[model samples]
Target: MRVLAFLDGTLADPDQAHLRVDDLSVLRGDGVFETILVTDGRPRELGPHLDRLARSAAMLDLPEPDRAAWERVVQLVIDNWSGGSEIALKLVYTRGVEGDPNATPTAFALGMEIDEKVKRARAEGIAAVTLERGIGTDLMERAPWLLLGAKSLSYAVNMAAVREAARRGASDVIFTATDGSVLEGPTSAVILVRGRTLYTPPPTIGILPGTTQGDVFRAAERAGWQTVVESFPASELTSADAVFLASSVRKVTRVHTLDGQPLADSTELHAELAKVYDSQYD
Candidate 1:
């Protein structure tokens, strides 16, 4: 529960008192955000996360973020964190109050302790269910207003999807396109392994480009594995030697079951992939 926040230029406690009702993030969910993983007081894959945040902000037509300010704030939160080997650093900036387009954006950097659930999932694999996202891969290109590729504050739909997965006795949700193509997880990226080939859905398919996945791919390439970015069907998860949901915070958690069907043996492959992941940060 340890937490700190940098609100605008002010460093303060991240309690309810620091939040404003009129903030666009609270009122209309008009904002962009990034969740970074800090291990041993070091924030991993920070450059890519910042790049993605800026890209998402551009997509939303929001003001560009102040990188130096954000870096200072990130340091502030990290310095204030008292416990935990891992931390979740969340950066948020909204378009500001409605009708005041020129209003200064409401920005904050939050540092909080990582949840124990993440460690449990990494230790023991998780079960997932495939849910239709009701949109195709081409929709992002045609309907840019949908903001499908941007990581925005409007996550109620994703939260509901995860809740629905919980109701169905699953730990997470893998969203498939309307055409049954595996898109991604509600908050993570999907990766499948067959032999030495690692597959992840193409970012062109309207999925957020995963910084963790990118790091894994780079590590995999260095380990003499082939990495492919392509649109894959949900059935691919069933046929793969291993399946994982990857994100900055979650890292790589093997998926033990998909739609109640057990996946292939993931223990060996999970260890190998994890070795590659660990080697990168070390």
Candidate 2:
């Protein structure tokens, strides 16, 4: 439970909150966030995470973040925290207090110990269920304000999806478009492996671009694997040699079952991919 926070250039106790009541992020979920994995007090793929945060902020019409300030604050938190070998570093930026049109965006960085559950999932694998997101693939382009491509604080829906999966006796969820196109996981990017080809959904179809997935694909490419960005139906998942949900904090987690049906047990592929993942971070 060790936690530390840097709020608006000042270090603060995370237990003792400092956010205002009128902050739009609290009131309307108008904000963007990034969660990076910190190993031995160093954040992995930091630049890409910050780049995504800036892009998300832009989508929300919030002012650009002070990247240097965020980097310094994150490093400071990592240095001062007493967490274990790995930590989850989260950066958040809000639209600020309501009614104060010129109010500065409320930004903060929080660091905490990584969850044991996340580690276990990577080690043992998980089962998922496909759920319809009830939106068309091109809806984001037609309705830009829906904030589909942005990783905003409005995660209640995603949280609900995971809960629904749990109630159905599953550990996670893979959301599909109304037309049954596999989009992504609730909180991670979905990657399907077939033989030597790795497939992932493209961002243009309204999925959040994943920094961890990009790193993994690049590493896989160097290891003689082909990377392709494309969308396929949910049924395609069960046919793949292996399936995984990748994110900065969780790293890589294999999916062994979807809707209680067994998927291809590609332990060999998983081990090979794990080698690539470890080599980069280690």
Candidate 3:
């Protein structure tokens, strides 16, 4: 099932939902967006997603999102999603039509059923290869114009990296900085497990702040595990007790292999973490 709603909290037929060809989101990729995982009709970690959306908009010099209006649209989508037990809910805000002096921002909410492939990856884990991000970790501070930490609509580089991973016979990718620091996945946050501690790179390193990673850390802390936010070298990934890629729709996915090198089997540990992770949705 699919659901669509506009910023005004009015439902729209999915087939009729449209955007102008001149919309800046199409013309210049000038927009911000968030993908949230909805379970049992409830959008998970919604507040954080909205918070990040506002941050992205501000970073792009766009108007601040009206939170209450967006929330209403989300609820409207959820009310219309009657068949799916899980939904990949996306919120998008774009600078409106180009060259139109009176154009206002365009915003909408869409919810669709989660793909079976995503479910399989979450359950069976995935193999990934590391790719260099071609920039140093300090570039974000050096060039703020890059919008490094914002979840903007310009994702060509990210998509290209994913394609590169596929060409290399891998299902996903982990991006590393020129300084050899582990960064993040093309569409997810990278998490490394060592003994009883969980580690993830800090958002200061030019990666989007991950909502699912935050939830995973909270789940770990509640389960008596230590969690650290710091930068670690890419070399550490292969040596870690376990590695995971966390995202909203995929949730927590273990890395079975990195660059075709088999990672240590941590099924028991993964189960423990997965249980804790799912409990957050409860």
- Highest lDDT model number: 3
| Model 1 agreement with the true structure over 1-282: per-residue lDDT tens digits | 556666545667566686668888888999999999998888989889889999999999988888878887777778778888888999998888777757888888887787889889988989999999999899898889999889999999999999999998999999999889999998999999999999999888898999999999999999999999999898778988999999888889999988888888799899889989988777
Q: Point to the candidate with the largest TM-score.
A: 3
Which residue window of length 10 is worst by lDDT in model 2?
A: 1-10
Give per-residue lDDT, candidate 2, residue 95.
90
In candidate 2, what are the lDDT values of residues 148-217, reduced to their tens digit?
Answer: 8899999999999999999988889999999899998889999999889999999888889989999999
Q: Which 10-residue window in model 3 sums to the lowest lDDT?
A: 8-17
What is the full ranking by TM-score, best candidate first? Answer: 3, 2, 1
TM-score of structure candidate 1: 0.97
- What is the C-alpha RMSD, rounded to one decimal, of candidate 3? 1.0
lDDT of 3 at 250: 94
In candidate 3, stretches whose alpha carbon ends up further than 4 angstroms from where it belongs are none
Residue-wise lDDT of candidate 3 within 108-176, one digit each (tens)?
A: 998988898899989899989999999888888789899999999998899999899889878899999
- Please report, in order, the local distance difference test score of every candidate based on alpha carbons: 0.88, 0.89, 0.92
Please state the error at residue 44 of candidate 2 in Å. 0.9
